[model samples]
Target chain A: MPDDSLSRMSLIEISGAIARREVSSMEVVRNNLEQLEEQGESLNCVARLFPEEALADAELADQELSSGNSRGPLHGVPLTHKDMFYRKGKISACGSKICEKYLPSVTATALLKLDQAGALDIGRLNMVEFAYGLTGHNEITGDVQNPLSLNHIPGGSSSGPAAAVGAFLSYGSLGSDTGGSIRFPASCCGLVGIKPTYGRVSRFGAMPLSFSLDHIGPLTRTVTDCALLTQIISGADTNDPTSLNHKKTDYLENIDSGINGIKIGIPATYFDEKVHPEVLREINKSRDVFRSLGANIVEIDLPDNFEVCNSMANIITASEGSSAHAKWLKEKPEDYGSQTRERLMSGLFFSSVDYLDALKLRNVILQEFLQDVFSKVDILHAPVVPIPVPTLAESDIQSNPGFIEYLMLLGHCTRPFDYLGLPAITVPAGQTDNGLPTGFQLVTPPLEEALLFQAARAYEKENSWFFPVLNDN
Target chain B: MSNQWSDFIERNIDVPEVKSALKSAKNHSDIKQNYICLVPFEAEPSGFSKVISTWKLKQEQTEDQNA
Candidate 1:
């Protein structure tokens, strides 16, 4: 197979091809490394490259396969992760100057699980400073360019993972979402991403932005690839007490299960008011696609006053995030990028009572949202962003009060889900008038990830991701 | 320290800590606190994961009953 062709294959496809000996592991690794060094520069998606290390691992993987020993499902398949996931003693900068040389004592459990599943770690991708920002603008490490158009924002915090997978530097990646980080970036890059149920995946070693809302999951070009990665890394972990204790659902097994009777909910009031007509146009098309797929589309009015969840979520996030960085904010105030430092500082403004109210309200709102929406349909679908993908220059929220509206608009569509602690997935729906790709988000009842994947797969079969055309362009 | 000070920061306006504080404070005011039953007596704060697990259990039992 051609080098780029090998790189373009989905994670599961690459795994199967490597197992079949059609393309050697070394060939796949080498191609990606070349792509990372040559064409990957303009995108600024990579923070560091482990060329020699990756190649040696790939060679070893090939030898093991040649000896008739398969490591596991992802055997020899290359993957990348957000820098926040530590591999003990390595520099997991997390797009912050404060941790430019900081080394972690323990490796993230998610990384350990991926290693056991036989994925080759290629490099750490760029992200917003400490995974705090929304537009992937890291003053510390430079911006991660959108794969579709380098000029547009690669929705961020999980900026690097989305860009890397979208650019074919890695077949898939692990990204953590606190408030729309994973879903936003993946949607911007026109890939599928899931912010699994809050406790569905382990957060044992990943850096904490907001403990209550943090979730780790996958981003990939195809829905099945996302499903496979989510499966391998999910399960109870002794190290993270909060990790879900439920039996793992084999996401890939019934992934192809037709959504024949699935009732998908479309918002009637909230999102329509916030979204641009062109962006709404794309999401409406996805709704129509679901309708044509023999699935029912029900109109859902967001549970009354549930919009307060967004503000309440903000209180919790600022309170928790401030606590996480309190020491750093005091000592190394100059170390943080202005944007990240200030975002952390906002947490100081929320009192303990405010934090408690947000926490208590979270349960009340979540129980209400589930009963109100899920009783009507199996899932809820909405636009990821109010407008088409914005250019990097316009989204510069650092001290430019003018661009603050862009930041608010982006968060309005995402923050509520984190507050509700439900599982949300974003899949490329179509492109907007500016020729930039836009995605629609589908939210499911807690622990209903399989249904989310099944529904997304049904959509994927009809409207494939928008990244392939980026290569042709 | 103040909402204006924090809001002056790059992204705080999006988070709007002051708005959240005031809204939550009003809901927690003494008058309504007595009447409104703020939370369930036995409920823990941020037991979202437990809620999800309970939800999953209910789903499974319902499926079994139908079968």
Candidate 2:
């Protein structure tokens, strides 16, 4: 196969080709690095590139493959990690200057797992500073331009991961989610991201913004790829106390199971209110597709504390983030990005009572949510973002105090799941009339990622939607 | 307010002393209700479990037969 063709193949396809010895790991890595060089400038996805080390690793992988010792699907696949994930000996700037030269002495469990699975780390990708913002703007490292449209925001926190995957610079990428960091960028970039159930994946060495809500998952071109990646990374880790003790199951096995007679709940009130018309239309289109696939679409109402749940997430995130960065704030406050510093500083203003109240309210809301929604529906469907990808100029963070409010609103349908610690998956439903991609979120009860992927796969396969053009690719 | 809560408040906010003052002064009873109940809701878990399990079993059986 041609180098370009090898670079363009999906994670599963690349693994198959490698297993058959049709391609060498070095060849695949070289192709992907070449693609990265050709497309990385326009996408602005990579924050750090280590081509020399990557080639050496690829050579080693090729030797292993020749010896009939393979590391399964991820072995020899070229992938990247979000800049925030700690990789020992690699500079993890977290897209900020405060830790510009800081290299961790330990590797994140997520990165270690992927490495053990035979994935070659190409480089670190850019992200919102400390994973705070959602607009993919970084004052220190420069904003990551969207591959689909240079003028648009590439959705943040996991911005580079999504942009890289969407641009075919990498087969798969790891992104951490507190709010919709992983899924939001994935949706904006027209990729698939799963914010697995809290504790489903370990966060041991990941830089923390909000410990209570952080989840690690993958961004890939297809839901099956997400499943494959998730299977390799997820499980109990002794390093992370919060990691679950659940048995690991084959995620790719039931991905194509039809959604026949599946009960999908649509929140009648909360999701329908104040949503952009274009977004609503796309969601309805997805619903129509699901209905045609024998899904039982049922209308349901959100919990009594739904709005409070949104507020609680904000409070907890801000407070916990401020506490986490206290030392850096005290010493190198000027080193941080203006927006990230401002947001983290704002968290420092919440009274301890307020923080505790937020936690108390979180418990109350989760209890109410479990009693209400999770018990009834197999999965809850909603728009990942109420609005399409807005231009970078429109969301001027300097003048607008409402920027965070608007961001929270865009994450309104998603934050509740974070607060409840439920598993959610976002997949491309279709595009708006103007051709911007929109995603439908499928949220399920805790640790039911298989069901969410099942429904997502069914919907994705049923409607073969067109992918957004990668400008100048 | 207690010392632990006071310490927690101090560490999180920018003006920790101000927050401590506010927490001490503000009445706990002044808590406002921000909850919005959509409707009376009930969940039938038994029915939901049965449906999901049956679906899984059918799927496995179909795969087995194909094999």
Candidate 3:
């Protein structure tokens, strides 16, 4: 295969090429590394590159594939991970200066599972400091530039992962979502991201921002790739007490089952309120395609406290993050970015009562929301962000005084699901008038990722929703 | 004047020293009243669910017409 072809191939396409022995894994890895060198500097997505280790793994995978010992779809796939996931002997700075040299002795369960499935890890991607902020600016790691527009923020926490995938430097990547970390960047970068049910994917060895709400999932070029990645990493792990015991289901098998008769809920109030006109138009267009797909569309209203979920997320994340970094904050206060340090320090102001109140309120809010929305529809659909991808300078923490408010607005649509522990996927819907990408989210009940994938794929097929830019290579 | 309550107050609000002083005040009710005001109460539940269900049914019917 041509070097450019291998470098630009999707994970699904790469698997087929490898399966047919048309290309060696080493060839693919080398192409990816070459692409990284050529295109990566502009994107600034990769924090570290492990070309030697990655090539070695690719050679081993090529040998296994030739010997009829293929490890499945991810086998020989070159991928990277968000910096928050620990990789033994590698720095997991989490885009923070405090742990710049820290390396965990163990690897994240998601990484281990992907490795076992034969995916080659090439590097660690940049992210928001300590995964606390959402606009993807990190003082310690420098800002990750969006591949599509150098000036626009990549939508972050999973900023580097999304940018890398969008730039085609890697086939797929693992990104954690505490409150829209995965979905925000994916939507901003015009990629697919799934934040699986809390505890559905084990969090063992992944850095924690909030133990109760953090979820690790995938960001990939296609919905099916996200489903495939989710399948390999999901299910119970003894190491993670919160991991679910639910039987793993085939996420990809039923993706094309069609959304005929599937009920899709559009929250009448939240979905329509505070939305940018362009974003709303794109969401409506996606809904039109769903209508053509024979799906039932319903307008459901979210519960009363849905808006408060962001505040709830802030209180819990701050309190827990403060506790987690209390030692670091006292000893290494100057090590953090101004915004990140301020955000972390604000946690100290949340009383224990306030933290516990937020936790209790979270349950109440989730229960009320599920009761109101889930009972009426199979899945909920909404615009992932109120506005299109903002310019990087617009989201700069230092320059933008209202950055926190704007970030909260972007997270507004997503954080509620995180608090509810539901499965949600963001798929490319269409583009704005200015030509930047826009996406809509599909959300399902906790542990119901298969349904979410099915709904997403159904909509994906009904419209030419996949970004043409992804094929620009 | 310093106590467990004082530490909790100091960490949560900016007035650590003042709050410590206030903790020893004979008229503690006024401070308690001020603190309670900051707590957010649940808003009156909106009947959004009912509106949503009706809207959903209407949307489905509309899609059916377009199909």
Name the best candidate (by TM-score): 1
lDDT tens string, model 3, A1-473?
23666756778888778878888888888888887777777887877889899998999998998789988667888888888889999888888878788899998888889888878888888888889878888888889988888888888899999899988787889999999999989988889999998778999999999887899999988877788899999988999987877778899888879989989998878657888999999989899889888889988877755766667777678778888988887787778787776666656655676666666555556556667877788899988877877887766755234545656677888887787677899998888876778898998766678999888877666664554322211
DockQ of candidate 2?
0.08
TM-score of chain A of each: 0.97, 0.96, 0.96
Better-scoring candidate (TM-score), 1 or 3: 1
lDDT score of residue A10 within candidate 3: 71
The Cα error of candidate 1 at residue A328, in Å, is: 0.9
lDDT of 3 at A412: 82
Task: Quote the lDDT for A259 in model 3.
Answer: 88
Residue range with the least summed lDDT across 10 consecutive positions in model 2 chain A: A464-473
Question: Which of the numbered candidates is closest to the native, going by highest lDDT?
Answer: 1
Q: Pick out the ten consecutive residues of candidate 2 chain B with the lowest summed lDDT.
A: B36-45
DockQ of each: 0.21, 0.08, 0.05
Pick the DockQ winner. 1
Model 3: residues >4 Å from true position, as ranges? A399-401, A468-473, B1-67
- After TM-score superposition, what is the CA distance of residue A135 in candidate 3 from its true location, in Å? 1.2
TM-score of chain A of 3: 0.96
DockQ score for candidate 3? 0.05
- Model 3, residue A215: distance off in Å is 0.8
